[model samples]
Every structure is written in structure tokens, then in C-alpha cells.
Target: MITNLIKTFIELFGDSNEEICTFFAPGRVNLIGEHTDYNGGHVLPCALEIGTYALVRKTANPFIRFYSKNFPETGIITVSYDDLSYQEQHGWANYPKGIIAAFQQLCPIETGLDILYYGTIPNGAGLSSSASIELVTAVMLNELFAQHIDMLELVKMSQKVENEYVGVNCGIMDQFAVGMGKRNHAMLLNCQTLEYRYLPVSMNDCSIVIANTNKKRGLADSAYNERRAACEAALAKLQKHINIASLGDLTSEQLEEYKHLLSPLEQKRARHAVTENERTLEAAAALEKGDLARFGELMKQSHISLRDDYEVTGTELDTLVEAAWKHEGTIGARMTGAGFGGCTVNIVKDESIPSFIEQVGKEYAGKIGYEASFYVVKIGDGAREIAEAKEMSV
Candidate 1:
């Protein structure tokens, strides 16, 4: 893959006098702590080995050229530094464009560049693919331009691009995990304070498997924004009676006391946010004590809240989780991400992974009428420039 990416870069832009740099930014999966980031709660997420790869070089011309192997039909997109506005036709390129636009706010970009991108993440599967591309672009700019932007700042900038530029009201967890992930570890992050600690993921004799429903979600078209609005309305109702800023700040007892303050539907929304926050904290503690059972239990509880309380998980996700629960050697299974229809993260005994996949695949297809994809993922490091090779002068 690396060789092909480098070769593709040369083929697209020809030999350059300057050195070409290769950078990688990984996609992220939230092991637990769903829908809690926006509520100022704790989240557990780790970077995955699959993500986006970029080969970049500075060009003499004042025009930016972007190409992607994933979207061959779009061809090479050409834009100037002066014209950084979003265009619907740009498609996947907008992710990188938003990152560049954010960087332009900090410093002047004198020279344009040529970049080739390739991503391994399944699109619209609720994995942090957009964040992967954004962080990759940020890392490339920081190195090539010697900007020296802090990693946390890059994370923030990436989130800003997604929120203000790309127009998704997502929380900081995705960008944070992708920007600061450590190998063999998951981050326990406080979305409000941005305080974080890495917990070693010692899943002895087990593997983390992701089951994709293959049902794509367009954020704008999905009920994601509606759910966020529901939470906001719930919070506002609670604020009038109690002194709480977000549902994350409330305990189960406190929420119960203020239960009458919100509508029945709003009550369910707030309950998921509050309880999921608590579950995430407890799950971290269980992992610290090497209690996989307790951790697994918390994962199950999370899915229930998402399904019953938050009402995000559709039939496809519910079917997958229900099927996973019945399988032997399964520790736990739950829907991850925003959860209209995406993937479920499950911890299963290493020996049972094959049977688990086979059985779940068969059942899901029989019921849902489409095939599902499965991946066994490993936790990996955050974004960084990996290789720098001097181009042979022609």
C-alpha cells in the first residue's frame, strides 16, 4: 500500500525537486461512551490501524492539486489557496479543504501543493474516516510548512472544520482519539476538560471485532441532528429546575429527581446521556482492575440505553447486537458511533471469532437482506509523517 501510494504520487505530479513526505492518520472506534462527547462526558476510544494515507509535496505553482484513489471518478481536484470555500462537487476533498482553510486562519500559505490520498476505512460506517483525512492533512501541513501546531490544537482545528466547515455537529472524541491515540491502549477522555489518560487494553485471549451493517448514514439526512437537538432541549428543561449545564454533570439520582421536569421522550434522551457517562467511567475502572466481565457488562448496558432510551439503533444494529449476544465466547457487543446504522464493536474470545463472524454474517443477511462486513482491528498510534525521501532531480 505504501509503495503504491508513493508511486501514484509520482505518476500524478511527476518527479519533484523537493522531498516527498508520506503521512498516516488513523480512524477511531469508540469502545464505549456513545453520544456522551457532546454532553461533556467521558469517552473511551482508540485509533484503529485502518485509516487514510497521504503523499504530499510542495509545488512551485500557487495552486493546490488533490487526488484520491478511493474516488477515481472525481479525478484530480484543482483549487487555489486563495479560493478555499467549500464546493459540493469537491466531495471527499472537502475534508482536506476544511483542514487547509483552518490552517490558513493561523498562517499564510505561500506555496500550493500536490497531494494524493487513499483511505482504507469503510465510508459512512460510523468510523472516523473524515477525521482521519483531516488529521492527515493537518500533519502534512505542520511538517511541510514547519507550522509546529500542537497536537491538541490540531485536534481542535479538525473538529472545527467538521463542525463549522463540514457542518456536522460532532463532538471532540473522534478527532481527539485519532490525534492522541497510543498503541495497545484506549484513551479515557473527559470531553469537557479535555483531560485524558491512556489505559492499556489487555484483552487477554480475546479480540476486538467490528461488524459493519453496510448501511450508510449521511449525517445531514439522518436523525443525528434531531437527536442532538432533543438532548439540547432536554438539557434546557433541566437547567430551569436544576443547576446543571449538561446531562454529563448529573448523577442517576439527580436525574431521577428532575425527571418530571422534561417530557417523556426528553427524559429518555437525558437518561441515556447521564447513564452512559456513568457507565463509561465504571467501564474504565473495570478495565483497570482487569475485570473484563464487568467491562463487558457495561458495554451491554450501553447498547440497551442507546437502543431503548436514546432510540438511535435501528433494526440492523439491534439484529447484529442481539445475534452477537447469543453467540458463545462473546464478551459483549454494542453499537458504536452515532448509531443510525453503522458498526458494532464486540469483544470475543480469539478462538470463537471465526464462528462468531460466520454465524452472525449468516443471520444478519437472512434477516436484513444484505451482507455485512467484519474486521478485527488493532489499536494504533496517532497521526504522524512516516517517510521523507528526496526526489531525484531530473
Candidate 2:
């Protein structure tokens, strides 16, 4: 695939003498924690083997030219470094442009480049494709400009691009997982403190299967911001009655005691944040002890909280998860990303994967009247430049 991408880049930009380098950043799937990132809570997420790839070469021009094999209709979208503001007409190009604008704040970007991106992650699947783009661009620039910035700082800068430039009120989970992911491990992140530790993913007989609902969700235009705003308001009300910094700071018992301080909607939102944070911590403990059954139970409870308290999962997500629960070999299943409609992360026994996919796909189609896609993915490393041989395997 890298060979073909290189050929395409050369064909479009002419045979330039500059050396071309390739980079990769993987997409992420949250295992248990949902709608808790911006609430200053804990989250569990892992990077997938499938993500966005970039083939780039430096140029003397003052403008950056962007192309994507995923969206051929857009062709090559060029942007001058002077004008990096968001533009609706630019479509997907805004993501990369946002990162460039962010990097310009740290160092001077004097020369431009030609970049070709090919992503395996499905668009609107809520797998952090946008963050994948942001991190990949940030890593590429870090290499090109020889800016020896710390990886954690790059993660923060990528989150800034999402919040300030892309206009999404997202938390640090996605960017952090994309930038700091380790192979065969899931990160336990404290969003408020930015402290994290990787827990080994040692499901010896189980595999991680991602099932895409095929229902498109636009995050910037979705109710994601409204939920964040609701949580913020709830935290403010709780502060007046108690001494706490965020929803994550409160326990379930404390939240029940102070539940009257917030409105009905605020109470539910706060409850989800507080309880979900606790569940994430417990889930991590369960995994640490190699108790898959306990982890699966926590995962089921997490989905119920997200569906009832958070009110983010719609019919599609609920249907898929409910279907998965019917399978006896299923260990756990839940909507992975910021709900509405996206994919679900499930742990199924190796021998049951085939039957799980067939039955789940049939049930989903019968109810939702459309086919869903499934992929058995392995946990992968974080963003970086890919070597030629490694690129072939990726």
C-alpha cells in the first residue's frame, strides 16, 4: 500500500527530488468509560492496528497540498500557511489544517509540503479518525522541523486542535491513546491530571472485535457539546453545595447525597460521570487481576449507565449491544465512542468469533434494516514514522 501511495504522490506532484517519508497514527476504542473524558474522569482506551497513514515530502512552495485516498472526490486541497482558519468548504482538510495552525504557534513553518493520506478507519464510525489525522500530522511536522518536543506535549497540542480549531469539546483520551499507545496494552488515563499507566491486555483466549453500526455520526454537529455543557453546569451547581473540582472527584454516595443540588437532567449527567469514573477504576482492577468475568460485568453496567443516565446511545448502539449479550461466549460489549451511533467493542472467545459475527450481523440487519461491518483487531503502538518493511505489514 505504501508503494502505491508513493506512486500516486509522485504522479500528482511530479517527480520531486525531495525524499518522501511515511507516518502512521492509529485510531482508538474506549473499552468502558464513555462521556467521562471532558468530565475530568478516568477512561480506558486502546489503539487499533487500523488507522490513518501519511506519505509526505517537503516542497519549496509556501502552501500545503493535501490529498486523501479515502475521499477522492475532494482531490487535492491546498492551504496557505497564512490562512489556517477553519473553513466549512474545505471539508476533511480542516483537520490537518488545524494541526498546522497549532504547530505554527510553537515554531515557524517556513516551507510547505505535499502530503497524501490513506486511512483504513471508517469515517463517522467514532473511532477517533479526526484525532488520528491530527496526531499523524503533528508527528510528521515534529519530524520534518526537527522539533524535539515531548510526546505528551504533542498529545496536548493535538487535543487543542480538536477543541479550539475543529470546534469539538472532546477530552484528552483520544489524542493521548493515539500518541502514547503501547502494543498489547490498554491505557488507564486520568483526564484531569494527565497521568496514565498501561495495563497489559492479556486475554489469552479472547479476541477484540469491533462491530460498526454503519450509522454515520457527525461529532461537531452532534449533541456532544450539549452533554459536555450539561456536565459543566452540574459540576458548578455541585460546587456551591460541596467542595469538589469536577464530577470525577465525587463518589456515587456523595453524588446521591448532593443529588438535589442539580436539575433532573443535570443529576443524571453528573451521576453517569461520577459512577462511570468509578467503574473505569474498578474495571482496571479487574483486568489487573486477570478476572475477565468481573470486567465483563462492569462493562455491562457501564453501558446501562451510558444509555439511561447519559442518554447518548441510540437504538442502533443499544440493539447491537443487546444482540451481543445474547451470545453465550460473549464476555463483554459496549458502545466504544461518543455515542449516538458508532462501533461497539466486544470480547469474544476465539472459537466463538465466527458465530458471534454471523448471529450479531444478522440480528442487527433484521432490526436496523442495514448491514453492519466487523473487524477482529489487535492492540497497536502509537503514532510515528513507519519504516518501509513495517509499512508493508501495516
Candidate 3:
């Protein structure tokens, strides 16, 4: 995946690039919960095998230069770390810029760099591309300066970059998973409290297969904001009768008792949140009990709710989920992450991964005009830094 990074660094820096520092942060797939991060609910996510990698070296000038072989563009921005508003190419360089802004708050930085980045995590399949870049940048700066920032603090700093600088109203899930994910386990994150547990995901002879629908939904889109507003409206309505702050606190009976208090749209939003929370808990229990069928059933139900109530799933996402559902080797399938058009996460038997891929690719393409791309992934480790071969010169 990083063939280009390896090739280009050798061309630009040198064959061995002996002075460069490398870091990686992974994109993630949320298994059972969707759209619940901001609502103080639980989610299950893990780092993918795919990630964004960076190679960095320090510079004497208070300037940062970034190279992207993937985009065929180079970014140059000069600013004191104290004045972090400076930006280069806003598209991809924004992530590194975000980390610079975030880190300046915690550490003293003169803020000049020579960085080259290449990534394998698909850009818009709901796999936290922004978080991947930010974490990689965080690791790079930490190692370059010998700051030795703790991994958890590094994650919080990256989250601040998104929340305060890059301007994405994201929860801690993406950064946390990118920072703390362990091999073969999904991170069970309590987004509000930031307490997490590693849930071992030993899918016996199984793989997490992501079906990419090739439709990108930006969270800045009005519709996504509308969904959030709808959920907030539901919470406001529920608070009058339930004495609860959010849908996370309401039971199905409590919701039924206050059913008519909310408008139809708000009611649907609240219903999805409450049910999704319940399903997440159930799915967690299923995993603990080794009940794949129950977990799978909850996943299917989750997609239906996300499609109908949360109103996030698009036709492509629905079709991919349907294709996976119809497959023999798949235990459960759902449109994962913040949906509209993204990847469908499927729990597939390892032996059937190939046929499942082939059949689903054909079936999804037959239904939709576009062919679905499949990624067979396992949960992997979080952010890591490549120790420098020699002390770098500024």
C-alpha cells in the first residue's frame, strides 16, 4: 500500500531516507453502533489494517512543507506554532495543520517540518481518514522533538484538532480507536466518559469484510447536521417528561410513555438512538457469550433502523447490506460508520471470504450500476512511531 511512499521518499529525500521519522494511524470500522457518538452512547470500533503513514524531518525555518504523491501536490505553510491559523492545501494538508494547531497548545513547537504522506485507507468509506492523518502527524511531531507524548494524550490532542481547528464535530471514537486499538479486538468506547474496554473479536475463522459503495457523505453536509438537530430536538422533548438529558437514558417504555410529545421526525430520531443503544449493549453481551447469531441479528436490525429512522443509509449502502445479508457465509451485515454511501461491515467466514467477495461484487454491481470494493481486514494496533535511525538535524 505504501509502495508510493517508499518510492517517492527515496527519490525526494534519498534511497534509504535515513533521517526520516515515520508514524501511522489507522482508519476504523464501527461494528454495531452508528451515529451515536455525539449522543453520549456506546460504540464498537477498531483500527483497520489500512492507515495513513507519514515520513518527517525537522527544518530550520518556521515553515512546514508536505508532499503528497497521491494528490500530486505539495503543501507549504509557514507560521509560528503560536499562530497556528496558517494553512496550506486545505484538502489533505488540513489534517497535519490540525495536529500542529492542537500540539502548540500542549507543547512548545517552533513549527517547521518537511513531511511526505501516503495513505491506503480509502478516502470516503466512513473509515476515519481525517483521524488517521491527524494521529500520524501527532506521532511524528512527538518523536521528532523527543516530546514522548503519551498515546492517550496524543489521541485527545488529535480530537482537539478536529473539534477546535479542522472544525469537524466528531466524538472521541475515531481518535481513541486509532490511538488505542489492539490486535483482534474491537474497542468498546463509552464516548461520554472516555472509558473503554477491549472486546476480543475472535470471529472464529471469520473476517471483517468492508463493502465500499463508493458514495462519499461529508459530515458538513446539511442532511447530517439535520439528523443531529433532529436527535437534539428529540432529547429536548424527552427531557420534559422523562427527566433525562438524552435518549441514552430513556427506556423503550419511557419512550412509549412520552411518544406523542415529540413530532414524527423527532420521534423517529429518538427511537433510533434508544434502540441503537439497546442493540449495542445486546451486541456486546452477544460477543461476551459467543453468540454470533444474536450479534448478527442485531447488526441487521441496526441497519434497518439507520436506514428508516436515522435516515442516513443511501440506496447503495442498502444494496450492499442486502447483498451481504443474502450471502451464506455472512453472519450479519450493516452499513457501518456515518452512513449515506459508505462501507457495509460484514462478518464473514474466512473460508468463504473469496466466494463471498466474488458473489457480492457481482450481485451488488448487478443491482447498482457500480461495483462494490471489498476489504478483508482484522483489528490492528493503534498509533506508533518509527524510532529515528540517527538524531535528526534542525
- C-alpha lDDT score of every prediction, in listed order: 0.92, 0.92, 0.80
Cα lDDT of candidate 1 equals 0.92
Residue by residue across 317-359, what tens digits does model 1's lDDT show?
9999999999997899999999999899999999999999999
Better of 1 and 3 by lDDT: 1
Worst 10 residues of 3 by lDDT: 385-394
Task: Looking at model 1, report the run of 10 residues with the lowest lDDT sum.
Answer: 385-394
Over 132-241, each residue of candidate 2 has an lDDT whose tens digit, in order, gives 99999999999989999888999999998889888898999999999999999999999999889999999979999999999998998889999999999999988998
After superposition, the stretches of candidate 3 with alpha carbons farther than 4 Å from their true spots are: 1-7, 13-18, 73-83, 86-89, 387-394
Q: How should the candidates be ordered by TM-score, best one leading? A: 2, 1, 3
State the local distance difference test value for candidate 3. Answer: 0.80
Q: Candidate 3's residue-wise lDDT over 1-394, tens digit each?
A: 3444555665765443335667787888899878787777889888987888887766665677667656664434344555557354456677788787766767767746778887888778788888888898888888777787799998989888887777677778888888888988887787777778988887877888988998767765537667888888888877776677667677777888888999998888888988888899889989988888899999999999999989888889888888889989999999987787878999998999999999988988998887888999878889887444224311
Q: What are the TM-scores, per candidate, against the unseen true structure?
A: 0.97, 0.98, 0.92
